[model samples]
Target: MCRSKIFRICLLFSAGYPLFQMTLRLIERTFYYPVSEPVDTFTILDLMFLGIVLAAFVSLYLGREYSDGVIRNKLIIGHSRMSIYLANLLTVTLGAFLMHGIFFLAMFLLGRLYGLPMELGFGELAPAALLGFLFIIAYASIFTMVSMLTASGSVGPVVALIIAFFLMIMGISIYSALSDMYAEIPPELLADPGFNPLASRPKWQQVLFPLLYNALPSSQAMQLMDYVAYAGAAKAGHLSTVVIEPTVFPLLAGTSALYDLLIATFTTAIGILLFRRKDLN
Candidate 1:
């Protein structure tokens, strides 16, 4: 994995992209905004592309291993299919973590160099970081499962990429629906005492939207990004003063982590079971 050119390229991207984003943010904060508010080191869109990249990487890696008979050779050498699947999962998860770590380190160092305030303290940042790690694990489990189950190495990446896009689109749709449903009423409408925003929406949508938002990995990423941005703005004394309640944010973060763990565990178990029954020949 270390010698793979794709891994090397991903490493480069993981390290370089943060620096590039920080530079752009710095420029935008300095020249574009009239008020010159403190630039946030973290953005709501930070990890949006990570899912697609990891999907592509894991799919390609597994495909190569399958094509070159590495998996078959491992079985011949007495490794169980379960063990092989887990080993690959662990390798990819660690690689994803390394990429995430590089991004965080770059963002922090740049934030310091550029004199941007560290908005969230260790207490607040730790859970967000853990949530991000769990998210990566979930992504790894999903792509590894898809890639391992598919016979053709060439076909795995295409399928994995499609799944990644589908998850992203679904997340976006859920987010938009929630936004529209909860949009603030016009002042004139609010002036009427009986106006109720919840009355117009169906009961099922009220329940389902929030459930999917918390449950899906893509939606969780979006929520996590929003939390980070809100926390930063609150700490920086920006106009967006209404911050998420301190305790509420932690509870939400914990819930999101639990969801991610369930996803990773469920997907991995299913993958191992399927691979065990697969015929290599």
Candidate 2:
């Protein structure tokens, strides 16, 4: 399963990346947008595509095991349910890592091939990538829990996919709203100090949103990609303060790691307890 699964994942990305690049290039030539570069075009592909791909892979993978009675057989052979769950979790985590690694390599290769400007050096990119990696593992853990908990193999994938999609949407929405919170005060608003919008908000509202936004796995992905986008522009010496301030880099990276760890730990614990009592018959 491991060898074949890894091969399938590699094949998916190998075929997918070139086609994605072509589509982006076609869009660039046919349509007009401010940004034009391979990396810039390709960086955010993971934001949506990663979850979709992983959701599909994980659901189908675990679902198949149940349908084929592999889990039942393992249990009959005296393999503890806990071991089965952990083993599958570890395998899927490795698969997720491999998938992301391939995508990352492809992005870099394509970036160089197309002469895209990369503003952030390894110091910046490394941390962002690490946080993003943690988010992916966390995502995998949650997907595993869902996949295992569902009774129908056929329906499990669908449920997991829905969950993945919902979280992605929720994360993006929260990130956008929180980002708006920090938008520069308008010149007109500055003149009317009494009309300060941010000042009107409760202290907890200000603190809670960013914390919630950062808690989401999707936000980690968003922040990582956004960081790359800003870094690229800065490298080209075309920084845009109005649209996005890169000052959130530290905050994004730090919170991403913290939240991902907490969520992953929580999910794994819950998954083990639930799976132990799940009736295989």
Candidate 3:
């Protein structure tokens, strides 16, 4: 336990502390919009912070599993790999939850100091706050599962990043399928950018690309951007002036949780079942 503590202290400084610093910078640069109301959706800081936390946890999970042989021999006690996985999950979730709770407290006090009409009512804000916590945790878990399966935890972030690449590629690949179907429509309507979701691609193609994009967990960043914007705008009371809808960000976040669960379960199940039969020699 003493060794685990010392090792974690080092790892936190090496990876996690840098992530927190990045989040601090992100909060300063990206969360600078004028006051409108209290928090509602997410901000760039929120999304980037989530990614930073996810990446940090993934890296460490992989690092720990890789170092497991040494830890077991040195400590004269070791858990089954499943125990290791669960303990890591709990540690990541708890640490992030506590840190974010403190972050929210700091943001609230800062908002109050600035005389912003930020809502502090637990009844009103608790659900949203809880949902955000769950969303990040779910995202982290998916990244962790991927790290364990890849044999190189370092590849976790790259795989998560590929979701963005998938979106760009899938979008271009199906643009032709969409244009061909929409060619029969009125030219003026088809020409309008606002009509593009349906007009740019047939329903099937639209749904297909979204599926491919969703398969990449990082693709959820596109959706979470709306939540971040809403959180900022809500804090500033900018929502009233905005004509656009709230975009159901919570639902989208929930969908991300589901996607991560489905994929992670499959990946971990395969790895654990395989691990039981393997021999390093």
TM-scores for all candidates? Answer: 0.86, 0.82, 0.58
Number of the top TM-score candidate: 1
Q: Rate the local accuracy (lDDT) of all candidates.
A: 0.76, 0.71, 0.50
| Model 1 residue 277 lDDT score | 96
lDDT of 1 by residue, 84-128 (tens): 999999999998888777777677668667765567765666567
Any runs in candidate 2 off by more than 4 Å, and if so which? 2-11, 22-38, 117-126, 187-199, 202-204, 242-244, 247-251
* Ten residues in sequence with the least summed lDDT for candidate 2: 36-45
lDDT of 2 by residue, 83-146 (tens): 9988988888887777776666666556555555555554555555555578777888888898
Top lDDT hit: 1
Error of 3 at 167 (Å): 9.1
Q: How many backbone clashes does candidate 3 have?
A: 15
User: By the TM-score metric, which is better: model 1 or model 3?
Assistant: 1
RMSD values for the candidates in order, in angstroms, are 3.8, 4.0, 7.3
